[model samples]
Target chain A: MQFSGDILIEDEFLRDGLQNEERIFTLAEKLEFLAALEAAGLRRIQVGSFVHPKWVPQMADTDALCEAMPRNEGVTYTALVLNGAGLDRALAVGLGHLSISISASETHSRKNTNRSVDEGRAAITPVIERALSEGVTVRAGIQSALGCGFEGRIDPARVIAIAREFAALGVQEINIADTAGLANPVQVFDLCRKLQDAIGPDVALSLHLHDTRGLGLANMLAGLQAGVRIFDAAMGGLGGCPFVPEATGNVATEDLAFACEEMGLATGIDWQKLRAPVARAEALLGRALPARQSHVPSPPWLREVA
Target chain B: MQFSGDILIEDEFLRDGLQNEERIFTLAEKLEFLAALEAAGLRRIQVGSFVHPKWVPQMADTDALCEAMPRNEGVTYTALVLNGAGLDRALAVGLGHLSISISASETHSRKNTNRSVDEGRAAITPVIERALSEGVTVRAGIQSALGCGFEGRIDPARVIAIAREFAALGVQEINIADTAGLANPVQVFDLCRKLQDAIGPDVALSLHLHDTRGLGLANMLAGLQAGVRIFDAAMGGLGGCPFVPEATGNVATEDLAFACEEMGLATGIDWQKLRAPVARAEALLGRALPARQSHVPSPPWLREVA
Candidate 1:
């Protein structure tokens, strides 16, 4: 039960959340969401990805979003950069934070980024070096670290090796992602222990989880018990894996915040304030989002106790 | 990290799953679901309730369902009985297992059953006596033991007192329910430990949880860590509290089972076989159900690793 006193939750609704969404958001709508997230007290936010527009039209407005988003002194705004071109685009927009990722599973690596795992690993050094030269905070993510849709079970050795590579590059953080959302708590606990051991204490560790198997929050709990303090979550459980149509996106931001708050951990995000953007997203999507707090009406009693 | 080696998951899909559905299912469909649950290797199931048909038209054909359900020697089928009259009906139908429950919160007691908490407590003794006299296995449940919709937070001491009462009546099992789904892992862990200590080990403890707050599976993990083995879940996450239309019903059986299997816990239920019933329920309800495994395709890799 011994865990961190404070947990940092990075809102990835605009990046991982909206990446695969069919409905594209305009620059204004994206800015609105950014404002809302900032207002809700989230310190770190992943605005969008710098992938090709043809592949992921949902995030085509990354440059515009980055340029127009309000700059707060304390808030750290990051963008997902897949390769050198993505890093170039992020640099052009004066973005200070960049997250670069490669899948741990070979099949998923090729399918997602059109590169083999080895190629993906080799490509990271220059990108990290370029971004770091520009004084940008870099986060290296290992996707499908637990399992994969196309490749099935991913080896933990691959994930640990990737963590070592990221550590050698002196990245600020290493993100272990359950890309296919197929991880269990025991796997999370065990793998996190290994990764923490391999990566050493100098680099921070974060987890990016998908709720595909309904284990998102449970995995978060496991990660916390295993000494991980940073997590990635979506606003309204938006962004399902396109590979698995039935899979939910990242864990809902409000839901994770509520769970952490109830566990006596400090997240510093107001769970109640998250409802507005979630409601707006549901209305825009014209469907109910899978976030638990979105459906629950705020009763009068909650004000006193919650 | 110490938990039970095996968990007993009781499928309450028929009673709690369908109670709040706008659609009314025929007796034959209910039988189909029942057979599917049996085929899936669930040892315990809650088939229906004996509440007044006028109050809950969805389960109007409980009598006929009880009379015609397939009898499996290996499976234990049970039913919910709210009052003496319902118990009389269960006895008349020759049902061997019955569950009787009362709310721990006074406001919820008055709202749901039209009785004060004390009155509800007073009523259980005679009902338990009658069921035991008839050689029936009676399970006593305390609803709102974690929280209540009407009253918000409920005292754990009230739950302990009720467990003591059920123990005095020599009931076979006691169920502590999060009727409003307001429970967090810390609360679940603390309260479960208290309940187990107060109720002792001879009387088996079960949990009836609503996924209203999206902590269904997380709370299940907590309960497992706290030494609770038996849980109540509905197929496809059916049955929200009738009063709270937005609140989800019990945790989805397939989702819970999948998570348990991944964690190396023996539930003994064939997780793959649950798809048919869940799909059928969705078709009957004419909407997508929230069972995670129902949507995930069975990959060949799952056979080797999962």
Candidate 2:
């Protein structure tokens, strides 16, 4: 219940945020966002994903975007890579950090990757091994680790098994994703505690939460109580699982960062500066995003009286 | 951290929800919502507020709506009354429960009711006494109890003093409202715990939270952790403080109930059934509401497989 300590927030705006939008963002627009995000003091950012253009048209220019990204000291840029081809693309672009993920739910795994959970695990293991062997920092993720749209109530033991597998593969971090956002605070706390116990402390555990059910921040609180320090958030709360029914955005970066700052946790994020990217995204999308802090000005209490 | 036991959720859709909305709903429409809420197993419902029509045009027909409301068994219907005139109106309407509230912040008090904090307190003291004399169930509330948008941070001592004043007057409940939605979970927990210690167990403390910065549910969780059981929510998350800029809806009734049920707490609310009223509200308002559960279909995990 006591939240004290520093937390690392990984902004996935350019990747997860833009992947689901119908209109594909040009390279220039993405670079503009990247610059804004970097300028906002986000130390960790997911630039984009190495996915097939046929699968995710919005992410077709991930390689080009990565090649054009400016290398900044003290900033870690990551990208999601699903398969061997995606890994090859990431290596070709000389990306240092790569996220390799598979769904914990069999139904979700097949639907998302066109492979069963076992096949998906088998496929990602080699990619993870290859990435780690090449000195690339790998973050292995278990998608739908909490629950699934097609498959109900994913077992915690299964998620723990995947986390253990990822840990044994020598990944730097393991992420438990509430891909469908079917997670409550109690479940999040219990599952995160169990995962922490299962994986031990050497491997860092991160949470990728969605706000589909409005429990995203509450769940994040639970994760914090359970000893998680890394979280994935998107600017303007953009991003959703296309395969999941009625899936909304990830927990908004500004909102999450604001909560962290309010809780006395050091996130090294200038949450106020995040409004620029969110505003730009809103303009490009031609609609107001769901991020609450982005739309509402900070209350007087949060500001310094001159 | 442990949230167990039964909780009381007072649905304020008819009162708080409609107050800030631009279009005024007809009495028949309100009655329909009342019936829907009742049928959805909501035992406590705030029908509307007895206020000047010039101030809140949406609640003009509160007395008529109260008159037409069916007297269901075991149901507690309440109305918000701001002053002597509003109390007289409630008495004339033969209402059994009334909420007399004042802002804890001086600036908010003056802006909201045209009275300073002390003046607002003095003005409401006689109304609370009169209502108690009439054997009316009274809920004395401190608006902006946690933080104020205009005045910034409200001192916790002020809120406790007001609660003590109300308790001394034999009020049935003390409600703490985050009118500006600026409360963080840590502050909410610490303050609620302090208030509980100050007030003792005889009087119940309920939380009235807004989702302005997307922290409503998280703050609710903190309240639960602090051992305060009663809460106020609105159908489809309808409601915002007009005095507070960019204030969004109250915590969604369905979302709050869903979180409770998922956490193994009994709320006596048929959350799925309440979607009917939410759909109707959205239709009438001509916009999607902020409630997450209402917009998204319950995932397969929540539904029983036939």
Candidate 3:
């Protein structure tokens, strides 16, 4: 159960974090935040989602963001695409990195994407192939992989089968999301182990966790024990699961980095630098966020050492 | 690791929860909450503390609380006794169970109890012996066992020595508390494993955690993986570390139970039964508490099944 290496965190604050927020930032504001995240030494950033403006107005400036933000040599900037139209927008906007996301649970797939799991699966086939052919690194993610509100507990076999399909299609990574925030440490360790075994170390595994039930960091610990290296988190714990209003969405990036650092895992990014962006988001949103460490002033002991 | 059996949780809301709150509950109110907790199936309840009321006015009515609350056949009611005087108070009130607690960090010991670590350790010797001699079940706890605000991190050897002394005194159990909420998952796992090995399972191991850095439940998970069962949690996330105002104290009792139940561990208490008491506390305090599961109305899926 030793964590041997550095973990790569993909900052999803711009996409998943802002999507559910009622206050939509302008293109300039979004770009400035992106630059700040990059300056904070984040290697991967989910800049935006190519979703319709009507459905998710917060992400309406996806094309504008991709067009304006400067690309860095070492950084990987990705955007989420749910269907063919969203994919077309990503390609049209010259998105260099892409994620094709669908739910593993049939009920969640139908309600969220208005398609059956099979249809959603079949639809992403061409998207993955096209992205690969276009020299784009693709990440295939299964939402509600652990459990769903409407579907109760999702079967490990079903999530594994979807990951196998994505692995066969040559996607760079496979992501498992606890969309309903129902995963416990035991369940997370079990699923991560099985997924790693099924994928055979060829495809990278990522975990997207929620703190809805206050188990986000705990699940992340279990994932680390299971040898997972990539995690998706939002700054200031900005997002909330749309399905569960009171449920805080993605794990806070600063909190996760702090926890990882404390565990002797390298995260490259400075945990202290996360507070500025978190404060900015809080002021922009005009509310106190739920991330614990961000709200705390650095004590003298930590400050002196840092 | 598989978690097969049940876990015992000590409800510390009445004591630790209120001690840190600015609002104080009346003796009648405290008794009403105690009855509700018993009805909720909590086997172990820390009703109040035997601290000087002048120092901590919130626990001023501990005597009245202990005298009024009805005792159940299977339930074990406990009070925290910080010194010999506190132990005498407990004996006078007929409190059956008592916890002798002091800090593992010397700096924290000096600040909190006005004594050095060694002095605090020496002071508890006769307290433990007296409690045991009088047929009282004694739980010896080491506060700030993981890390400290005044002292950055506590040495495992220091904590282990304290536990050894308590074990030699024939205490019923030994508790390791994350008093400053400075613990991470790795620290928790290591300390729990070391304490369990040193105590040799004859003395039951318990953990008292605070959600100061949002790692309370995560630490709880790591502790579970390390095979420690008994936990101390507060209802409605009602407390914060007195040393750090921003640091939320105990893990919310309802949240821990819900997380344990999700992980297939029986907590004896139903998660659904937690809200009424949480609401009562919130109303009495006239504020919204930080507990997550308490605020979330149980959806149909969880309700029908439970």
Report every candidate's CA lDDT: 0.85, 0.90, 0.85
2 versus 3: better lDDT goes to? 2
Model 1: lDDT to the true structure: 0.85
Clashing pairs in 1: B239-B249
Q: Which stretches of candidate 3 lie over 4 Å from their true place?
A: A241-247, A299-301, B243-246
Question: How does each model score on TM-score?
Answer: 0.95, 0.97, 0.97
Tens digit per residue, CA lDDT, model 1, A1-306 = 433488899999998887777888888989999999998989999999999888888888899888888889989999999899999999999998889988897877777788899999998789998888889889998988998777677889889998999988889999998877888888899999999999899899999988887789888888887899999998888866554444467898988998898788999998788888999988888887778786786543566634
lDDT (tens digit, per residue) of candidate 1 on B1-306: 434388899999998888888888899888989989988889999988898888888878888899998778978889998899999889988999889998898977887789999999898789988898899999998888887777677888888998998988899899988877888878888888888898889899998887777788888888888888999988787877665444477888888888887788899988788887788788777888887777876543665533
Please list all clashing residue pairs in model 3, or write none if there are none: none
Which segments of candidate 1 are over 4 A away from where they belong?
A: A1-4, A241-247, A303-306, B2-4, B243-246, B303-306
lDDT of 3 by residue, A1-306 (tens): 346579899999999899888888999889888988888789999998987788788999999899899999889999999887888888887888888889987877886678899999998898888888888889999998987777677889989999998999999899999887778888899999999888878889999998888889999998998889899998787775554444466898888988888888898887678788888888898988878878775543577744
Q: Which parts of model 2 are misplaced by more than 4 Å?
A: A303-306, B304-306
Please, what are the lDDT tens digits per residue for candidate 2 over residues A1-306? 467789999999888888888989999999998888888788899998888889888889998988898989989999999899999999999999988999998988887888999899888999999999999999999999998878768999989998998999999899999998899999999998988888888999999999999999999988988899999999889988767756689999999999998988999888888777788788889999999998887878666721
DockQ-derived CAPRI band for the predicted complex in model 1: medium
Q: How well is each residue in B1-306 modelled by candidate 3, as lDDT tens digits?
A: 578789999999898888887778899898888888888889999998888888788899998888888888989999999999999999998887998899887877886789999999999899899999999999999988888776677889999989998998899899999887888888888888888898888999999998988899999998998898999998887776555454576899889998888788899987677788888777778888888888765543586744
TM-score of chain A of 1: 0.96
lDDT, residue B23, model 2? 88
The TM-score, computed over Cα atoms with residue i paired to residue i, of candidate 3 is: 0.97
